[model samples]
Target: MLILAPMEGLLDHGLRTALTRVDGVDRCVSEFIRITDQLLPLRSFTRIVPELLRGSRTPSGVPVRPQLLGSDPACLADNAARLAELQPAGIDLNFGCPAKTVNRHRGGVVLMDEPELMQAIVAAVRRAVPAHIAVSAKMRLGIDDERRALECAQALEAGGASELAVHARTKAQGYRPPAYWESIATVRQGVRLPVIANGDIWTVEDALRCRAVTGCSALMLGRGLVRRPALARAIRWHDAGRPMADADVDPCVAALPWPQVLPLLAEFWQDVCGRVERRHRAGRLKQWLNHLRHAYPEAQQAFDALRASNEPEAIAAWLLQHQELAALAARAPEVEMTA
Candidate 1:
């Protein structure tokens, strides 16, 4: 199973809708909703995961599990119960985020240091939500090392997490290279619940290697999917034993051609325009273009072209022009060479 990672700031509902429109993504986790001391209003839940209003599925119909982040077991349970009223696909607890600000507040990866507290949080959430609502958790290896990785995983499982997704890194490792898939294997062996491997899966080979190393068939994709919009589809193709001769020759060909990606970009841009504030709209387009640069040279060119302009009108004009160019290129006939 390929699950889209819940990127806090980058992958909002707009991008979620756009990315899931392509094939191969089975599910998504919404950005972590931080619960403090109060029982948040239902609108707060809907505001973060508007999919709650739409049966907790993206516009393309992929199930989206809502994730909650906090340190208090009772408070999180209260919020989880409230969220259950919306009938989300599932309730995911966040124990994997590496942000220092989050950790400073005794949330996210810092909870890994206290496996007992983590277990309590998960148990409370499980009891609060109905039996039908699946309770899951995502966690890193540990705060600074892998010493407590297995213990943490066991605690979550013991606390009633039906499944777990391990990010394969510690708070100290923070998005670095060489995610510890071997360590993930140890955690998977230690737990009975299904374990999903996450972190550093950038290609079909990476996905296969992660699965082989961690012995986990499931993967949670974050920056990798943001960089290559069709990565999940390509991974599925590889799994189905489909031949992709051009994959090695050109990475972009394995995922999506530049021309084909243009429409998704347009869709993302439209979504951003409607959701983001006017002043921040252009930044959202540029942010996605920056990530797309890793796969497509055209994205690099587009980013360069728009780097100076923050005006929404200018970005809209550029999108229209390129879309027209792509349409024209598609309609143009290919000339046959006489041998």
Candidate 2:
């Protein structure tokens, strides 16, 4: 299955709705839920996994697997048992996040450094959930080295993980150059469970290369799909020996009226800011616009004009003017010049 990676603060229901409407996405996972010592209230779970409240489908009806992130086996198991009430398609454990706060808490990649602890957590969650509910895991190669990855995979498999998704990088390599797909192949060889390769699959060629190198049956796309919505479709087409046009390069971003585009962009920023903080929202929105500029160059001008505005309405007005300019530029070539 071609799965979308669960990028925190980015893959909310609105974005998930936009992505799943495009082709080639088989399923998606939610952002990792941070579990503390407390038995999280059902309302908190519902808010974190809004899909459960919305008929177990994304706003677009895409199936989403809720991901759990924590260090305590018992807390995680309790949460998993509660999550079973929602009847998600599966339960996914997160030991792959490379964020410092998560690692510092010994919750994410840091757990990869402790194979026994990882096993205990997975085993407990596995036993807590119903037998029919599939339990899987996502992990990096290791805390700092690939040598320990096989051992970590073995531990999770022994603990009854149904499958493993291996992001081909160490914690230290966090989103760096050259993801080691070969490490995924090594893990596949060492484990008996189905392995899914993830990391640095930004294009169709990259997907083909990952499949050839890792020999895995499935793939998980993260930033690539976010940057180019048609990436997965193009990759599937290429794999079928019939490549699609690079229509993703010219996404209808520029064509959308400013009134339509600005609100969606603002909504994305608002959702993130609510989860993060006001001090960080501007920089985060700018980063998103930078990605958007890859598909619509006008996004850069809009981002520059709106970067300092704290008020969404003011930013929206400036975006409207820019969108009009882009529209005029598109039509000017077709009109005949007067003598």
Candidate 3:
């Protein structure tokens, strides 16, 4: 199963809708909703995961599980119960975030140091939500090292997490290379619940290697998917034993071509214009184009051209011109043949 990882600031509902529209993502976890001392208003949850209002599914129909982050067991349980009222696909607990601000507040990866507390938090949330709503958790290896990885996985399982997604890195190794897929194998062996491997899966080859090394069929994609929108589709093709081939690229890793990617970008920009504030709209588009640069040289050119401009109008004009160019290119061969 390919699940879209919940990136706090980057993967909001707009991007989620756009990415899931491309094929192969089975589900998605919403960016964590930080639970604190009290129960949050329902609007707060809906704002982060508008899918909640639409049956907890993206516009493309992929189910989205809402994730909650905090340190208090009872408070988390209370909020989980409240969130259950909205009927999400599932409830996910966040124990994997490595942000120092979150850790300083006794949330995120810091909880790994206290497996007992992590267990309690999961157990309480599991009990609070209805039996039908699945309760899952995502966690890193440990705060400083992998010493407590297995213990933490076992603790989450014992606390009633229906499944676990391990990010394959300790907090100290935040977003670095070499995601330690073998360590995921260790945790998978230690826990009875199904374990999903995460971290550093950038291409179809990486996905296959991660699955082979971790012995986990499931994967949660983050920056990888953001960089290559068709990554999940490519991975799915490979899994089905029918890989797609591109003349200029490796058959196993070739994703959506530049022309194909433009429409998706157009759709994303429309969504951003609808929801994001005017002042911040251009930055949002630039953020995605920056990631798209990894896969498409066109994206590099686009990014470089837009780097100095923050005006939404200028960006819109650029998109309009490129889209028109793509259209002309598509008709060029037919025009030449007729001549």
What TM-score goes with each of the models?
0.97, 0.84, 0.97
Model 1's C-alpha root-mean-square deviation from the true structure amounts to: 2.1
Question: Relative to the true structure, how large is the alpha-carbon lDDT of every model?
Answer: 0.92, 0.80, 0.92
Q: Across residues 1-339, which tens digit of lDDT does each residue of candidate 2 receive? A: 789998987776657766666667888888999987978877777777788886667766677888999999999999999988888878899999999988888789889878999899999999999998899999999877887899999999999999999999999899898999998999999989999999998777688889999999799998887766667776766567763345554323322333345545655655655665666656666766767665555576767776777664565465556557656766776774631
TM-score of 1: 0.97
True-structure lDDT of candidate 1:
0.92
| 168-212 per-residue lDDT for model 3 (tens digits) | 899999888889999999999988999999999988889989999
Q: Write the residue-wise lDDT of candidate 1 on 1-339 in tens digits.
A: 999999998999999998898889999999999999999999999999999999999999999999999999999999999999999999999999999899999999999989999999999999999999999999999998999999999999999999999998899998889899999999999989999999999887899899999999999999999999889998988788878776454542565788888889999999888878999999999999999998788899999999999999998999999999998787666432322
Superposed Cα deviation of residue 337, candidate 1 (Å): 14
TM-score of 3: 0.97
The superposed Cα distance between candidate 1 and the true structure at residue 122, in angstroms, equals 0.6
Cα error, residue 129 of model 2, in Å, equals 1.1
